[model samples]
Target: MAKAFASQGDLEEKKTSFTEIGRGLWAFTAEGDPNSGVIIGDDSVMVIEAQATPRLARKVIDEIRKVTDKPITHLVLTHYHAVRVLGASAYGAGQVIMSDKARAMVAERGKEDWESEFARFPRLFQGHESIPGLTWPTTTFSDRMTVYLGKRKVELMHLGRAHTAGDIVAWVPDEGVMFTGDIVEYRSACYCGDGHFADWGRTLDRIAAFAPQSIAPGRGDALVGPDMVAAAIESTRDFVDSTYRPVERVVARGGSLREAWEAVRAACDPKFADYAIYEHCLPFNVARAYDEAQGIDTPRIWTAQRDREMWDALQG
Candidate 1:
């Protein structure tokens, strides 16, 4: 059977420049679109956060080709989301790296997430059929690990749960630049289908501690300078807090999902209404928040059918 496109709205798939941050570090970002980072070491290249598909990732590869022909030695998946990791095969890297937790998510709920995300944002999956299947990491780590591309050192750390249980960030200490997958978004909505609200806030705090001069967030424009980076983190924290707190408050007052959704909308709509993907993310955000507020630790699976059912129930 042919798969259906996910989003009903229009999206532009524009090409963007690869901005150089340090001696060998670059950020590839489309205007308000998913962001990917590149680190060129003495010997090889490491790409952080592959795009939605091989066709889309080729655009990034094209940019990388401009600088060097160094083999893409590593493709680091910051998390297990289909939009992020499915492009791994396109890189043809010898090692696909990820957190053990992230690999587990792929093993556990990858198929459901693939279906759910494809249904929600079709444009992101531009060449969906080209995807080999769910991306599985060849190398997995628990806490932290360091990889050297000749002399440059890239540190991968699994911070506390935020966007997902196994969310990881790539820190280039020498460059003072960080690649935070979906843990921090500039002007984009933080998708919370599998997020931990409370832990998410704390995770932001941990990211802030790095004091990155520049940040290439999971989506949206890259943040430059300390002020912009701080603002991005705070804005992301505010979005998560604004979405989760109101829902939690309503749940405390014995509110139904509809009531909780209303409360969340009332609190978040005014401030975050203009953010990218806010409309698409709100229903799932509220559902996850509601479940957490009711003491559900792990998030439930979101199938395409369940996505629409929840959206209709809460968004109505």
Candidate 2:
């Protein structure tokens, strides 16, 4: 039987959980669904990665109210994927922050991505009508930006291009906890449709330098403690390198796209088969890796039609 395309078959909703990784810091994860984070400081709260809609984001807000009543004053878009950014208005945050490159991506492809992702994952788009429109960051920084929630400080930095061209991670210096958007996925398939394979591995090296005590990845459970943090980073590094390296080798041998895709699926599926979004992401992942292996640097924007065309090209 042919597998369902992207998330079309993902009808079952996941149960969400809030794991407190540090004092006043929490990771909200929903079983491979897009995850979010909350950081409470002395004066206010900062949310990392908004859910897909106001209704979904309210659930995170509800979780926030349980621990701290601090107003959600800051919202950080780790990158401009619609699942991460469209829910911005729900928080009524004073400042919506993103990397300058990310802001440009949003401006350039936000509508297409919004349409593209919505079609891919319908389950994540509950209450989609409530979303006002494309999420625009009120503030954008080139390299790094710091926000002080009283004495606590949260720093946003674009380590390098990995998951997306504009990918960024949130680092809490005092807490020693990092919120890596999609740059790292723990035990979950790395969605490299918009990723830079070589740069991603180099970027992961930069993340390792911080030696975060705990790390919240784009998907999967939070990595608590230094040992777990290191393991997850290495695992993500390995996952990216493993999946793409094999495909790269095949492409260098003048293999067809199908051959490259088969090489990656054969290598990755044995281990990552049960990982979140593995089936949904594999084709796109292979397509991008194939292009990158052939020396494409910037990832092409994905439209709903582009997604289907690639899916059919590989799976038909």
Candidate 3:
């Protein structure tokens, strides 16, 4: 029998947790769902990574109301992914920010991605009708941009490419905490369908160089200390390396995608089998890694049709 496409089989809702990684900085994480970061500035708050729909985004807003009543003034998107950006309208922030490259990607393939993701994981889009349309950033920066919420300074920097070509991290200099989008995940599978596998490790190195005391990672639990921070970074690197190396070896031998799938599962399953979204991410990760190993510099856009075609091919 053919496997379910992506996360279509995943219908059970995950328990949500709101963790304080630093003073006034919170991480809103679901079991293995996409995570969002909250940075409570002196006068207002800034949210990173919107949920898939406005209804899910409102859950984060509800969590925010518990700690402080400050208005959400900024919504900073780390990259252009359907799950992360489609909920922008709910925030009603004065500014919605993304990297210049990310904005370009939205213009290029955002609609197709939205359609693909909605089909793959219907559970995330519980309130699909509430989503107005594709999320666009009102402001964009090339390399780095800094915004001050009164005395607090939050720096948004486009670190090297990893999860996607335009991935960025929000660094709170005063608190020594960083909100790394998908560039770093804590025990959660990295979704690499649109990733740059070759550049991912270097990006991890750049993140480690900062030695952040705390981190609100893209998924899983929030890292609250140097020990946990370092471990999560290294583990993420290991996950990326483990996934790509076996596929690269298979590609070098002129093995087919089916062979690469087997190779990746053999290498990754023993260790990452229990991780969040491991099964959902494996097929996409293998496809991208196989392409990258064969000298494909850019990941191909995945429409709903392409997603099913790829899944069907791999099932064989």
Span of ten consecutive residues with least summed lDDT in model 2: 1-10
TM per candidate: 0.96, 0.98, 0.98
Candidate 1 lDDT, 219-247, residue by residue in tens: 88878889989999999999999989998
Writing each residue's lDDT as its tens digit, candidate 3 over 141-178 gives 99999999999999999988999999999999999999
> Cα RMSD for candidate 2?
0.9
Q: What's the true lDDT of residue 17 in model 3? A: 97
Candidate 3 minimal-lDDT segment of 10 residues:
307-316
Candidate ranking under lDDT, highest first, comes to 3, 2, 1
**TM-score head-to-head 1 vs 2, winner:** 2
lDDT of each: 0.88, 0.91, 0.93
Error of 2 at 161 (Å): 1.0
Instruction: Report the lDDT tens digits of candidate 2 across residue range 40-75.
Output: 999999999998988889999999999888899999
Clashes of each: 1, 0, 0
- Prediction 1 global C-alpha lDDT: 0.88
lDDT of residue 268 for candidate 1 = 88
Question: Model 2, stretches more than 4 Å misplaced?
Answer: none
